[model samples]
Structures are given as C-alpha cells and as structure tokens.
Target: MNLKNLAAAALFAAGSALASLGVPHAAFAETTKLKVGYLPVGVYSYFWRAQDAGYFADENLEVELVPMAGGGQIIPALQSGALQFGISDALGVLNARKGGLPVTYVSFNFSQSSDNPVHAVLTTNPDIKSPKDLEGKAVATNLSYNTDWTMMREWLRKNDVDIDKVTFREIPFPDMLPALRNDTVAAVGAVEPFVTFGKEQGANVLGHYFTDVKSPVVLSGIVAMLPYVEENPDIVKGFVKAVNRAIEDFKADPAVARETIGAHTKIPATAIEAMNLGDWETEVPPSEMQFWVDAAEKEGILNETDDLNSLVWSPKE
Candidate 1:
C-alpha cells in the first residue's frame, strides 16, 4: 500500500480501538465533584445505592457522601457551602427557609407509609403502655423540631396527652436504644433499623407516629441552596435523575436494598432483614410541603408560612 493509504488504515484501526473501548468521541470529560451530606440511616440508603450502583458516575458526577448527625448540621453545611447538596427532612428545609436561609428541596428521598412504617414511638418500660402514661417523662428524638419530634408531639396531643408535661431529649439514633435499655429516656422516637433493633433489645412500639397521623407522608429529600440550584441547574438535574434511578432500583430488589443499606449503616443483617424500609419516592409535591407547613403553623413551630411551591425546586425541561 502507498504511505497515504497506510495512514488511512491506521486511522481506521484507531477509531475501531476507541469504539471497542466504549469511549465516545464527544464524551463528557469533566466530572462535577459534589459533597453530599446525608444522615447515616437505613431510609437514606438510596444515596449509597446510587453511589454503589454507578448511577452518580453515569451522570458524570463524583459524589462524596458526608455522614451528618442530622438536618441541624446538614442545613448549615449547605448554607455555608460546606456541602453542595444534602438530604434533609421537609420540616428542616421549611424551617430553614422561614429563617431566611435559601434552601429548597430538589428531589424526593423517602416517605413514611402506613403499609411500611419506619418511624415510631418506642418504649422499654412495661408500665408505659400508652402516650398518656408518659405525663412527666422524657422522650429521645434525633433532634429538636425535626420530623420525628414534630410528629411524636402531634401523636401525643392526638392521644390527649399534655404537650408541656412531656420533655424531649436530643439523642442520636444509635444511642437511643442504649438510653432506653438503661432507662435514661422513657421513650424514643425511633427510625429504622433502630426501631427493629430496639425491639430486639426489649423496646416495644407505642405507635407509628408518622403513619398514625397520615399515610404516605413526605418525610425527606435532596436539598441544596437556592443559589447553587439556580446557577447549576444541569448539575441539579443530573443529581435528581441519579437519585430517582437509584430509588427505582432500590424498590425493584429488596435484597439489594438490604445489602446496600447494611453496607452503609452499622445495623446487623437480622435487624436489616426484619426492619421495614421507608417508601422511597421520586417526586415531591407541593401538597406534601403544605402538610408540614400547616402542622408547623398549628404547633407554633412556624410563625408564618411561605408558598409551598417556592420551597421546592423543579427542573425545567
């Protein structure tokens, strides 16, 4: 062959090698590094699932999942730019907005379902049979003014229990079981797999607080600062797509969900298997935010409410 013909053959071979290696000519060469904050709980397993299942990578994203204590820390981290994204409860997001911190929900995380309840009021004391029994008792929650705290208070009130008579303590989820076992707290607002683990340690479920009030309540979801979301809409869209894909995969296979959750959390296999996971969803409706807003206003948690639609960030087509 002539030199020009030989060069043409080499170029053809180079293109074939690139195609064989699955390398696109116009590939997304840059990956957006995202520091994502999350509460290390079984319900937020989809974050780990998305990372482990390569959904985030598929979107050209490098997600660093930072395990946070609760929304209390996560919200501030988001505000200060320490975290680009975070998973926070609806109440936390709304409260932050109420306080003039421009944070908004970008995608759904998980919901509390009647069929598969994850959050509950648990007690180890045999004498504490009902909510009214804890008139002068202290109850542990992950944080004050959080979803669990708010719901448990509402649960107590619904049962005709005096709100002022009960005292709430802020304790992490892992420590709640020990606190209950040693009688440090009369009861705990437990989320799984602690709910299941607590039962294994002799704690009994007083009631499913979240589901008792309403079935399929929007619990928490992906959140970010409004400025970040507005400036980087594509990044936000990619994140939403990745998380939603992960949710679908998580729902399709229970075993995979268990494995993914167990890998991220310290829960034992038995507890993970026995525990009911949250109902993960992909969409966050304005009505769901309204539920929390109305509840917060009634409880005097929020003095005034904002338009629910403004609190959520919807991706433009």
Candidate 2:
C-alpha cells in the first residue's frame, strides 16, 4: 500500500508541474490575432502610433497597418471580411448603415471638443476672405456635397451665400494645394494634417468649422464587419484596450506619440499636431452622432429616418 501509493502521488505531482508549465499538448491555443485597417491621417494618429509601438501586443492582436487609398475601398473591404476593422469617417459609417451595410462602429477615434476645428478652408484666391466669400467661387473637395459640403452649404446659406451661385469639382486632396497655387480652385477644404500642409504652402486658411461645431459633424472611428464582432468579441475588446493605451500615450508623451505617428503615417508629427487636430478618445457621445444624422436630414442628404440603434456603435462596456 505504501510503495504503490507513493509512486502514484509522485507521478501525479510531476503531471501537475507539467500542466502548470503549459504543455502544448494540453494547453489552450493562443487567441487568433486581428488585422485591423486604418488610414494614414492625423485623425488616426493614435492608431498609427499604437501599431508601431506594439500597443496591441498586450491585447493579443497583431495589427496590420493598412494604408488605405481612400475610404471607398475600406468600406467594401470591411463588408467582405478582408479587414477585421477600419478607421473611417462618421459619414461613411452612417451611409453604410443607411444603405444596409453590415459594418458596425466599435469606438470613436475622436469626439470631444468645441475647438476641435476640422476641415479647414484653404482658399487660393487672395480676394476671397472668409468662408462666406467662397459662395460665388468654384470649390474643390475630394468628395463634393458628401462630407463637408453639407456644412459648407449650410454655413453659406446662413451667411446669405448663394448655394447655386457656386460650383464644385471633385479633386484629390494632395492635388488641391498645387491647384490652389495654379489658380484652379478658388477655395478647397483641408482637414487636419492636410490643413497644416496647406498652410505651409502659403494658402490662406479662410475658415474652419470644427472649431465651432463640437458635434459629431466629422469623425473617423474603428469599425468592424458585424460578423467579425459577433464571431470574435475578444478581438474587438482587445482593440479597445490597445487604442485606449495609445490615446493615453498620445496625450501623455506627445513627443513619443508624434515620433510613432510620424513613422507609421508618413506625416510629420509637427504637422499632425499643429493642424485642426481634435480629441482622440473612446467616447461616442450620443449627442455627437445626433449632430451628423440631424444635419444630414436637415440638408436633405438623407430622408427622415430613425435607425439610431443601428446607426451608432459604441464599445460594449
């Protein structure tokens, strides 16, 4: 009884020690890593920095820095599961929901401040002064009458600037600066990172609206295909933790954040922080989303609708 029992106990102790060491044959598999997509813009500075700085490592995510050509592909890629998540504007998310797209917002990248100052108006025409002055002139925007166009139009109408009196042509953002210098577009909308770049080029920053409109009028956030979120809540959860770390890093050691951002985004950190850079956090204040939806409805860009439940997506607490 004594010899046999002692031998069994020793074997059991050895097995327990091996188990504690996490033997591959018996241990649970590592979590599946995530490949999130993002654009190289100041709006996503934290995300870019976080990817480079290994912020997602703790969350078990291996971030893939996707340099998006534009939002057009990002949305479709999300739909097709080509991307686990993406950083894109509120307008694009709204349009996707309105059109029955299957993607859902995981968290807001930026949505907190009155002086946030997005979409700065850089006019080439020295004669055209304020935002009000651009009414009669032709404006160039990457996506006309879609994004800042509604707000621009509203600001124009409120200030008695005739909407029909002006014309709009779609021009890529980078091209606008050269176009401005060459006397092509009288005025162009330049959001952060680009705004600073435009200013450096000697373009007159006539006006900026994000400084006033503290609403969700403009936003770029984390979005994942609904299926991905459903299939892997853990991945989404990790993304939040990673971004949260990055956000704190951005505010705390801005110098380090800039270095990280400059490297990943290919946009200078000085240029990035100097622009109309707004808040970058996890808050998705309902009031902000209302601003975009209400503004769109008021401008007739969207008919009367009520999908607040689905239109908005915030991180699950």
Off by over 4 Å in 2: 1-31, 112-118, 215-218, 265-273, 304-306, 314-317
lDDT of 1 by residue, 158-276 (tens): 89999899989999887988899888999999888888887887788899999998897987888899999999999999988998998898778878889997787777788889999
TM-score each candidate. 0.90, 0.83
RMSD of 1: 4.5
Whole-model alpha-carbon lDDT for candidate 2 = 0.69
Scored by lDDT, the top model is 1
lDDT of 1: 0.86
Q: Candidate 1, TM-score vs. the true structure? A: 0.90
Candidate 2 root-mean-square deviation in Å: 5.5
